[model samples]
Target: MDRLAGTSGFGGVYGAGIARPQRGSSIVIGYESALAFWRRSRVEDPALTRELLAQLYPDDMLATLDAEALAADTSLRPLELPNSPFERIHHAALALGLREPVDIVVGKDAARRRSPSARCHVWSGPVSDGLLVGVEPGVYICSPELIVAQLASELGLYKTISLAMELCGSYSLLVNGACEYGVPSSTSHSRISSVLRLSDSFRGIDVAKQAALYSIDGSASPRETVLAVMLSLPRRLGGWGCGKPLLNAEIMLSAAAARECSRSSLRADLLFDEADLDVEYQGREWHTKPEDRTSDEARQNALMMMGKSCLFISREQISDEARMDGIALLIRSRLGLRPYRRPLSTGMSLRRHQMMLDFGLA
Candidate 1:
């Protein structure tokens, strides 16, 4: 429910509910044009970089970018493109030991499965990190960590869309289910597939003028309702989610909703103890317990360090140490900085891991 815009923590519920501004309207997030201006500046002035960060990140995130630290590290230069602002931040973070460098490939199926999934073939390498800088209106330095986080945050937004769609679709389906013989019949379930297909087809057509008529039809059958729900998704998500498959969006939405749903269900003794969620980076695994000193000030500090604007706390208030660990864990997880290990039970040693594995083990 908390919509923290520009903050590194939470991207908020459903991406500010803002329409994906038209293609040429302002500037798209992942397009090449977004960082085109960076090619012009040889030194890439610090002030210019700071301004770009201001435009791309929330004001609360400025300190974490470590403008001063970046300026001091003269070896760093503007990252090459064909990437995104989020990617650039990720590289910088890796270099700064803020996160692990991960190899992100966009393929038909990232996991090599039949389904269309954004495959994340994480390679272990030195943690890399970078700052977000705006080169021009359409261009900005790519922060890989931020981009991953942004994508992760989308899971929540997509959930809202799906649930809303499901509720509406289910309501109409219930009616259609009962339309048979004046009583609900199991045969109505078969209509779901037909409706899904119809919805997919409808996406290609314009139904602006037929809204009312379609609404009436949709109420007649669960299939029509399901189709209506699918058809309505593009409007909320802003044009079919790029190259990603429909199922990927479904999964992302489900994950986000699941996390939010579990927030209040966490046990009092359970702090930041998730193994996958609480990770190790740069040879150190951040502590899993919440900081002992709990207070609003500690929570704010943790949020600041973690670059997150949202918090899902347990019965005991979060402390500074807990916040710090949370931030480190988040950075590591987002950047893929943690040790790349096969499941411990699998019995694979680090030496057997790929070369890239050792490179990222630190």
Candidate 2:
């Protein structure tokens, strides 16, 4: 495993990219104004310092983080924050200190490949057999899987993949209380996590057929259908939407709705409580919250509307008549769309639930 470039706020290495000050450079020291306040508190934690700065500034203070201090601080370690998903599994391994066989490979082939020298597969993609991290052998604060999940959530998407492979040492780095040689006793063939499916249905198809397949009533998830429709088009054509096809079409549709909401001067209090919120959209004082309804009904309506719109856009270029024909066509196409409603019948709900109490959702 090779050492990656820089790691200031991510992974383990912190200060690799900072530039040193020259001897002739002017050094501005305002000890009376700046040092006096810091000395009164003398805080060491980066997150605490960031919190204080955000509190004091209350406006664009995120740029003030000192990468130099962040890297050199011994008390701090990689992925220490609760908000991050990276677990302290390596720390547990290091504590074990067993000399295990470490095998690193590039792709799925290398991951699944069986060889005498192999112990782990350094798969470059987001899929992780157990825990995944950097290609380098040293301490990593975050894994690629965690990073990908964060990116997907921020982008309001479900999944994303990478091409680069990292160090995938075979065997769990920790065995019981010590680092053992070769694969960890716990790692077994039964521990396989992800599997790929291949089929002939993914072959060449024209726009109409592609649209028809995706438009078939309730056969797949709205996001799935949208992604299928997007992938069916050429790269250039697909570029019109978000970069990742796995992202829900709602991201685009919601943006349009947001624009409409903004134009209509909606109000925050009408939709959500504004007690602790620090930000609000401009000219949004005229909006009306949707009437309270059963969750199932609301979800069904949303899915129907989203699916209908996505299929309409996918099948042909948008038209005024297409909008008007929705009701009549919906009745006639009820049978075709029957498959899409199966998930609802199974009693599964799509709304996301917050995991921890600290996130504020609880």
Candidate 3:
């Protein structure tokens, strides 16, 4: 996406813009520093990183990053940043309140000693391509997609899938692997690296591809992410293997239902459109409120009027493996799919159990 040249963002940071910087300068926030940034900032879905930085940092802190990183040219060229990956990561660490030794990505050619600086960890790799997302005129962070690909190298497939789900969904994942349902996803579909967009050029692309296979967008809460993964992922991987549902899908109500519900349309948490069903996730935190419960009932009635039966999945129900499996069976039956022949053995238990563990459900 082309960034607006002069628009201002939260805390006086231009939400999208790049200042000209000298070529061959390479200061980019990455790895552990990137993790810290992603965790601390709960940016709105359609947002830029500078908004977060601007709130936490002074304007001048980004001024150096904005300088000498580009050349004056009417035309653009292959992107490169200034050559100080360490300085970049250090600043990002400070900005994100990271206390651990900074992790910086250096070119493969950069020298490494048997023992390098104790204060920072060095990763040998070049920061090139479109992997680096510009946060401001000069500052950059690993793009959300790049971060996923980088992390996939070290994480298991379940964890990788969990991370991909959060990224694809409309919510953010916390450092502790908890979903911050209140925090909207920072990366938009156009900006996030998606399953279909996984490229061979990236490291761990194969793993990322696998992880993103069943991930769908528009999940507004953590439970929805888990629910979708549980239902949609292949049975071989311990998912119920029901058809993946469209998450947070907006459905316009018929004239009668709309007037009855007092709304033109409603978004279902997990929409089984083909089955004419709406699976709603009721979070313990808010849905218990009397007013919210009343509203949910009304929404369900309105949906039913359109021939879509509504199935409610409570936060409590999601926590129980037996209950969730039962729910999945019910959904598959409603969708007219054959029963999933669940296997009992062959090492499926741990892998199946790990999905819950990774998602903090277990």
TM-score of each: 0.20, 0.20, 0.73
Residue 225 lDDT in model 3? 78
Ten contiguous residues minimizing lDDT sum, candidate 3: 67-76
TM-score of 3: 0.73
What lDDT does candidate 3 reach at residue 194?
31
- Residue 7 miss distance in model 1 (angstroms): 10
Distance from true position, residue 220, model 2, in Å? 14
lDDT of 2 by residue, 1-362 (tens): 11122322322222232222222211111111112222221122334322222211111111232333223321222212122112222332333231222222223342243333223332232222112222112322122212222232222221111100000111111223232222211111111111111111211212212222222111112222232322222222321111112212122224444343233222221011111111111122212333322322333334334342212221222112234134223322432322222222111212111111111122
lDDT for each residue of candidate 3 in 161-267, tens digit (9 for 90 to 100): 66666765656755566656655454433333332252455456677667766557677776787888888877777777787898888999999999878999998
The model with the greater TM-score, 2 or 3, is 3
lDDT of 1 by residue, 1-362 (tens): 12233343222211121121112212122211111222211123434333433333232332243434333321222222232334443443343222222223221232221212111322111111222333334333333222222222223332222222222221211212232211111111112122222222222112211221222111222322322222222222221111111110111113333344332121111122222121111101223434432333343343334333323332121123234335434433543456323232222222222211211211
lDDT of each: 0.25, 0.22, 0.60
Sort the predicted structures by TM-score, highest score first: 3, 1, 2
Regions more than 4 Å wrong, model 1:
1-23, 27-43, 59-134, 137-144, 148-352, 355-362
Per candidate, the number of residue pairs that clash is 42, 24, 14
Best candidate, TM-score: 3
